[model samples]
Target: MFFYLITVLLGLYLGCVGMQLVYLVFIFSKTGQYHRERGSLPAGSAPAEPKPDFSAGVSVVVCARNELDNLRELIPLLLQQDYPDFEVIVVDDRSGDECYDFLLLEALRHERLRLVRVNETPQHITPKKFALTLGIKAARKAAILLTDADCRPVSNQWIREMARTMEGDKEIVLGFSPYQVKNGWLNFFIRYETFYTAVQYLS
Candidate 1:
């Protein structure tokens, strides 16, 4: 009688484990399929309708704090986006370095580049949030696209893609940024966490 009971319990545990494995596989397949559909373009296909006119305008906002190095490298890329009637706003949030002067120079150079200087953060709010608010408030365009100063767009069409996606019923578009993979456990962990966060949000 004891031997029979042990065998039945073992079988039940294996059945539960098998079901969980099946569930995980189902979720994994669904996620890959969804992203593959959303993130890729079919061969020789044109957009169904004309994309929203670039003349409608877009504001690309970036809030920086002591990121002179990143700003130097990225501002040119932002200014060079292949979209018409768009503005790039960079808010200098208490950056102790020469960021203010650098942006001031850039603004003079580019008619569409606007610079807002924040010498101090308010008593209660975080610096990043404060700077972002100021940038958005100063934006000239109704549609706003935001990105970090440390990040670069994969293509010159980044602004165009974002502006087009915002058309009709889509208020916010979520994008994925992948870090450069390196040969180290720490890098591996960071990449894992990034994908894990994306999956968590997707779920």
Candidate 2:
């Protein structure tokens, strides 16, 4: 009788764990479907129709800390954007590496690229958020586009597509960000997880 009772308890625990796993899988699948659908929007369709003679200034803010390699790749891509009246602001958050130095060199080469050095960390706890706020305040343009050190626009027309959607009195413009392909099963799983989450939140 005691043996049977022990067996039943073990079976119940395993069954509960199995159910939880199945539930998680179902949630993840649904999330992935949503993200794929949202991100699959036709190019230039995500934003609203463009207005005539509506040219607005844009400020691209990039917050960096110990991202020298990524900066080297990302900065050039940003500089190559086809936007006629846009400025790139790179905020260096007290990086211990040569990221700031590289940025300084890039700034010298590119007139549109501006560098800001944050010598002391702020008390607010979120360094990236603080850096972004500073960038926005220093921005000369009215429209602000926030991106990361590791991210880059897909093409030169990315700005035009993003800007066209900001008509009327809209203050905030949220866009989709997709992950790049990487080797290894871990990376695949991570990207899958990210896609799933984006689908759930964005869609």
Evaluated against the true structure, the overall lDDT of model 1 is 0.85
**Full-model lDDT for every candidate:** 0.85, 0.83
Cα lDDT, model 2, residue 146: 90
Q: Write the per-residue lDDT of candidate 2 for residues 1-203, one digit (tens) a residue.
A: 99999999999999999987886677646544644322456777664443623378899999999999999999888888887799999999889999988999989999999999888867866887888778888899879889999888899887777887687787987776878889999889988887766755654
Q: Candidate 1 on 43-158: residue-level lDDT in tens?
A: 89764665566656899999998899999989989888899789999999888999999999989999989999898888899888999999999998978989998899887889
| Residue pair clashes in candidate 1 | none
Off by over 4 Å in 1: 1-52
Compared to the true structure, candidate 2 yields what TM-score? 0.74
Best candidate according to lDDT: 1
